[model samples]
Structure formats: C-alpha cells, structure tokens
Target: VVKWNIDKAVKGDPDYIVDRINVHYNIGHLQAVGGDSTRPAGDYLLALNKLSKDQYLPVGPDLPENQEIIDISGEQMKMLASFPTPPEPHDAT
Candidate 1:
C-alpha cells in the first residue's frame, strides 16, 4: 500500500510514500463498494489478479485467476482471503 499527500500532489510536489506487500501474483484491477461514491467506502478491497501462478492449487496448464480479499479497516491493508475464478474477470465492484 502507498500513501500520498494530496496537498503535495495538488502543488505538483513528489512527496509521496509507498509500502508494498507480496500478493504473490500480478494484480490487474481492484474495487471496493462505494469507493468512488459520496458515501463511505467499503471495508473490503478486492484485488483481481491476472494469474494464480504459485498462489493456488496446481491446475496444470489451466491455472485459474485469483481474487484476493483485502481488509482495509485499519491503517494498513491486510490480505484476508484468496479465491479462484475459472474465467478471468474484467472488473469488480
């Protein structure tokens, strides 16, 4: 997870901080309920990973996509669960 000062960003300053955790595969898209709405954002953040890779059970040549459930209730993001999707999902809400 990364933290960026919006005030600095508005002034064209590069005062941003970044923190990263290994989610185990390539993540494509992410979404949370009411994330972009006026209401409060959801507590869960879903990471749509493009490849399961070494993160899931062996499926030989047909590896399923991964959906990593992340908990954003605290200061840091925590990965709660990982689920498999046979078909790749383009986006989520």
Candidate 2:
C-alpha cells in the first residue's frame, strides 16, 4: 500500500507518494472503511490480493485469495495482519 498526501500535492511532488507497504503477491482491490461513500473513514484499509503465493500454504491449493488488514491512520501505510479468503470463481478485472 502506498500512502499519499494529496492535500499538499504540487507539480513537483512526484505522485504525492508518502510511503509504501508491500502485500503478499498481487494486490487486486483495495477498500478503505467507507471509502466508496461520502463519509470515507481514513483509519484502516482492506487489501484484496489475488494470489497468496505460498505465504499461507496450510490454507491449501496452488494459490489462495488473500485479504490483508492495513493500518492507514498515520502518514505511512502499515501492514497489521493477513488472512486467506475463500476463492471467488468470478473474475472482475
């Protein structure tokens, strides 16, 4: 996850990048609490990664879906925890 400070963004700011935290394999979708609504909560974020990539083998299969909880309350994004999610047959780009 890359936390950006867009409030102070200017032309020379270089994408307003504040910090970054790596997830397991491939990050697919990201959902912050209330992020899709008018009242977006900025405290935490839920990251959906497409592949676990052996990070969680006990969960089984070649690769499993993963969800990671990240703390975004501060200037940098921090990885708090991660868990395997049930596979979704449908794929949405």
- Give the top-scoring candidate (TM-score): 2
- Across 1-93, the per-residue lDDT of candidate 2 in tens digits comes to 778777658556666888888877677887888887898878888888875666666655556678888999987778898877766423221
TM-score of each: 0.67, 0.76
lDDT score at residue 61, model 1, on the 0-100 scale:
69
Clashing residue pairs in candidate 1 are none
Q: Top model by lDDT, which number?
A: 2
Reference-based lDDT, residue 51, model 2:
56
How well is each residue in 1-93 modelled by candidate 1, as lDDT tens digits?
443457777888765433344576677877776777899575877778886666567676677788888887666678898889764776776
How much is 89 displaced in model 2, in angstroms? Answer: 9.1
lDDT of each: 0.71, 0.74
- Native-vs-model 1 lDDT? 0.71
